[model samples]
Target chain A: MARVQLENVTKRYDDVTAVEDVSMEIEDGEFVTFVGPSGCGKSTTMETVAGLTKPTEGRVYIGDDDVTTLAPKDRGVAMVFQNIALFPHMDVYDNISFGLRLRTFSDDEIRKRVEQAAEIVQLEGMLDRMPDEMSGGQRQRVAIARAIVRNPDVFLMDEPLANLDAKLRVHMRTELQRLHRELETTIIYVTHDQAEAMTMSDRIAILDGGELQQIAPPLTCYNEPTNRFVAGFIGSPSMNFLEGELIEGGLRTENFDVELDPGAVPGVGVGDDVTLGVRPEDVHLAEHADSLADHTAHIEARTDVLEPMGDEVFVYLLLAEEVQGSMEEDPASSPNQLLMSVTPDTEIHEDQAVDVVLDRSKVHLFETATGDALVHGLTDRSDQESGPTATEAE
Target chain B: MSDRHRTDGGETRTDVLTESHEAELDRGPFQRWVDDSIKNPQKVYRAMFYVAAIFFLVTTLFPFYWLLMVALTPEGQLQDIIFTPNGFNPGAFVEVFQTIPFHWYVFNSFVIATASTIVVLIIGSLAGYAFGRLEFPGKVPLLLLVLVISFFPPAAFFIPLNDLFNTSFFFLEPITGDGTLYNTPGAMVLPLSAIFMPLAIFILTTFYSQIPEGLEDAARVEGTTRLGALFRVIIPLSAPGVATAGVLTFIAVYNEFFFSFLMTDGQPESWAPLLEGIIAYQGQYEVLYHLMAAASIIGVIPVAILVIVAQEKIVSGLTAGALKE
Candidate 1:
């Protein structure tokens, strides 16, 4: 196993920059996933490490050797392409044993390694089947077996599971993790699906617009995102934001007010524009205000739409009566609307008036001008005055 | 009403078959056939297909049949226009051999055609792969130039080429010590290969490009060099196209007469191709149409055999680009 490192690797195509000066070090045997939206340079960065594409500016090292100019085979890295590019003319045995045969391995050794790999992929008794005769899932397993048969220092997979059906994709996610656990080889996986990155990687590197935004454990990225982009990208049904200006004791927007202790948030003064961020689950109803240790005062809202998921219901709350028409025009894109989640059985209906409160400890603050995080949680001395742990707001 | 009283399942099965058979009998024979044909349009289509196929087969094969009939007719009745030969003269088939050195002509044709086909396949596949796969400066323009060269008439280059072969190569002496390459197999092989190259290149290119580039990438990552990938993956996968090119070049060169007749002294000893040998029957006094037809039929045998053997490859190679994975 070898640790793959990219030092300021950048790739430019004439005028467009595919991957800009990005650098990261992955530990040996670590499963690191590069996650981003499409065309965000995540795959480009992985290609650089695999020696498939040479970086314009920086060096790539695998196990202390600068392999920036090395060929893919010489770099000791095997890649499983997104299309599962198995040779259609070859049978399973020949496809899996291609690299070994190219290296002139003995017949006995090639057979032994091929069988071991096929067993790992649960592909026993399929050595004679052509690729065209297999299902997509089985074909991808053959591709994976082909990669693992080489026993390279690092395995590069570029959206290897993207071509499978949704149900098979989930199953293969578990299979890949199990494979990683067994082989203990350094895997650098590239994917545009955030959930895949979250569930499989030891460290998930989140990128946006050809730049690295954050690289940390999945939960760390979900809980304490470094910027507004990461905070908005990590969680599904993304976090909500309210653009407000700083007041003396709290923040104020046209629809509502939030009280906060200035000392808890750094680099902020009066009249500084900021965006208050909170997840859908963190917005609580006023009736359950007693459950929270600290919360903002009750804000009047009217339920606009109710989406009933199996386990929970998402309630789109209109914060101001006057802005209802504009938000209803395109509810999903509106910033004036607050989305709150409650139990599926909750007594809620569309167009019903409701009162909601924000859990202060779960709120996040970011610089509205720069889209950078200011603080993750808010604190107000007035709410702490009720009790040390819990408060029932009036 | 009592017919509704069914017994066991076996009785019902026999009743259903009897009912269908009775219905068939009720309908007139032609009507039943018509109904069945209407229900399955494929039956009508198959019938029409056979009729048209037989018509075309007769129209196309009539000339060859006439040639065989003429070959069997004796020279005494050669003036008569008869569909059937009145005299069964099998001796004319033997007479074609005794008259001229036809075996030497067949040998020359085989040598030149085979050599030209090998040269075309080797160069055509390499050029096709480069044009089909690689990214290089001037690739588009160069491919267009190759296509544009094929538009020029082969006759246009005959004068310049003949002069160069006979006299000198631009400012240097000819490769041959006597300053002429006439009557040699290389003379025909070189020109035939050059003339037949474009079609082979185009055929191989279409087929080669249709192959997914991912296969080559996979091969490359598995430790094969670029050329190795070409030999191991691309060429093997394009066997149909390569065979098609080889067969086409061989047949065209085998029947070639213009340069073969012009470059040689019309002698089998001078390496004249089969078409020239057939022309050699037209002597100064009288033309032997009987022996000429026999020689023509003999010359077509090899090509006809080749076509029958590789017919599937030829069809598939031509239409390879029309398919998708």
Candidate 2:
């Protein structure tokens, strides 16, 4: 296994820049995922690393060797496609050994390797079965087997589990983690799902509009995002934000004013425009907030909608009456209108009036003009809870 | 077309979704096709569909029915009774063979059509794959050129093709007769393949383009070049399309008459496709209806057999992309 590094990699298609100045390092034996929305150039970056698409600028390295202009086959990487790209005409045996046969390996050697790969994917007794005859999950395994048989220095998988059913997707996620542990190969997976990235990768590189937003451990990006985009993108149901102007003691909005730690967000005085962000889990009921954290804001809110998600309920609270004036009005500007996540045991109902507080230690402050975060949270901030470890989650 | 191609490829895939559910795929064709979504199809709609289908089928098959009836009926009964079971005469079939070298014409047609079909398939699939997958400059224009070629009427090029074959009366002065294709199988085979190449390319290109692009990318990552990926993955998966192209090209080349008539000296002693042989029944003033009908029936046998053999492939090929996306 070799470390894969892309230095200032940029790819352009005529006038459109698909990927711009993307530089990242994937440590050997590390499972790093590239997570982004569509057209964010995450896949283009991976394609550049795979040598499938030539980078308009920059260099690619595997281990200590520069392989910038190498063909995909020569780059020592195997890719599992977004769609399990198994040859429908070929049986599992032929599909797995395609690369081996292409390299002109001996029949005995090919057979031995194919068997070994089939064992790795647990595809025994399936060698003679055509792709059409297999299930979606089995087809995916065959696709994986095709990649692993090559035993390349790096494995590139482009949303490989996206096509599987939800339950199967989760099952395969754990299987992939197990495979990564067993094989100890450098794997760079690209996906649009934040859950997959947080659960599977040692680190995740978040991209947007063809540019890298933040690249760090999943927990680090979750706890402390570099910019507004990262803060908004990294969490489920997304981190809620309330736009307001900075006042003498705190952030001032149309309705309630949230108390802020002045020292926490430095270089910002009264009348300065700012955005306040708090995670759903951080917005607790006033009584619960008092017990959990010290120094919080008390806001009178009407529960608009409550979504029960098994263990916890997502409660959408409207802090300002005018904010719900019309659906056409800017929804983002609805002051103090926050989505709070509470345990299922917590008594909450729709249209119920309740006093909720934003946990003082969990508030993130960003400059309104620039979407850059000036303050991540209160003190001794550790956001590891949001990013569950691979094993703990599975 | 690309938007249609963009549908989730996995949706069309019948690969195992679950053990018990997909196991049903191995049970029987009728059961598999009658999946839960379509198990209780609307009766009214199904009936209407069958009615429309039968109507079209009858309209398409009427000509062949008429040809068979005319060929089987005795020439003496042509004006009165169209068909009579016991009165059916096999004499015209033998008379047609005696009237013109029918077997030799059949043999000639097979040779020329087979040659043209083979050439079209090779050139068509190659060019089709290139146009479908490769990103080269002027690719759109080149594809448009192929489409334009397919649209050109055979009659529009008849005179020009005759001049090229040196068969026009003006070229028969014997001093400037340089066209080598005249009075040869090459004359018919070459033009037939050229005209059919566009259609073959169109069919093959569309089929190739429908395969998930990732398959080729996977091949490249799996240590094969683009060319290798095409031969090893794409082409093999497009069997239906190849069969479709082959059958269509064979039929088109087999039925071609204008170019064959213009290029070949139709004495049956000279090279002639079956169509040219059929025309021999029409002398200067009178038309041999019985002989022509018999010849027509004989000419249709090979094509009919080909269609029957490859009917499944043709149907699948035509409808594969229809439901997608």
Tens digit per residue, CA lDDT, model 1, B171-282: 3335454546777777788887999999999999987887787677778777787788888888877878888889999999998878887877778887788878788888
lDDT by residue for model 2 (B1-325), tens: 4455347666434333554585755656666556633765686468779999999998988777777777777665676534442257778889988876789989888988999999999899789889888889999999999899889987787777777776545544464354356776777887889999999999999988877788888888888888787777787778788898899999988887778777778856567778888888888977877678889998889999989988977666455422221
lDDT of 1 by residue, A253-322 (tens): 7689887755446888778998888999999889999999888989999998888999999998988887
For model 1, state the Cα shift of residue A148 in Å. 0.7
Q: Interface Cα RMSD for candidate 1?
A: 3.3
Candidate 2: give the TM-score of chain A.
Answer: 0.92
Candidates' TM-scores? 0.86, 0.76
- Tell me how each candidate scores on DockQ against the true complex: 0.29, 0.35
What does the lDDT come to for candidate 1? Answer: 0.85
**Relative to the true interface, what fraction of contacts does candidate 2 keep?**
0.76
Output per-candidate TM-scores for chain A, rounded to 2 decimals: 0.94, 0.92
